[model samples]
Target: VLCKIACMSRSRFYQSFKQKLDCTPLALQQQLRIENAAERLKAGESVSQVCFSLGYANLSHFNRRFQAQFNMPPSLYSRKNISH
Candidate 1:
């Protein structure tokens, strides 16, 4: 859909996107999702809520991705960052 909107083929769009952003579109999307999840978690949302709401079907997968981005799992991040 983005490729169509950009008036470029999929490969061309991927090449241009990578050249401009220094990352693949999927990587950017995952980063955005994890960032959003971090904000929601810091706001006191539960780990399961954040995971499923962000379209993550598996809690472990979400945890892995969250850990990869933030150096901690979502539960730990929330516990550390949430206001008392």
Candidate 2:
């Protein structure tokens, strides 16, 4: 869809996107989702809520991705960031 919008072939779009962003589109998308999840978690949302709301079907997969980005699990991140 983005390739079509950009009027570029799939390979060309990927190459251009990587050259400009320094990462694949999927990586950037995951990073954005995790960042959004962190914000939602800090706002006192539950882990399961954040996971599923962000279209993550598997809790463990969401945990792994969140941990990779933040160096902590979503639960711990919420505990540390949420206001008492």
Q: For every model in order, what is the number of clashing pairs?
A: 0, 0
Cα lDDT tens digits for candidate 1, 1-84: 999999999999999999999999999999999999999999999999999999999999999999999999899899999976
Candidate 1: regions farther than 4 A off: none
How close to the true structure is residue 34 of candidate 1, measured as C-alpha lDDT?
98
Model 2: per-residue Cα lDDT over 1-84, one tens digit each:
899999999999999999999999999999999999999999999999999999999999999999999999999999999966
Q: Each candidate: what lDDT?
A: 0.97, 0.97
Give the TM-score comparing model 2 with the true structure, all chains together.
Answer: 0.96
Highest-TM-score candidate: 2
Off by over 4 Å in 2: none
Task: Spell out the clash pairs found in candidate 2.
Answer: none
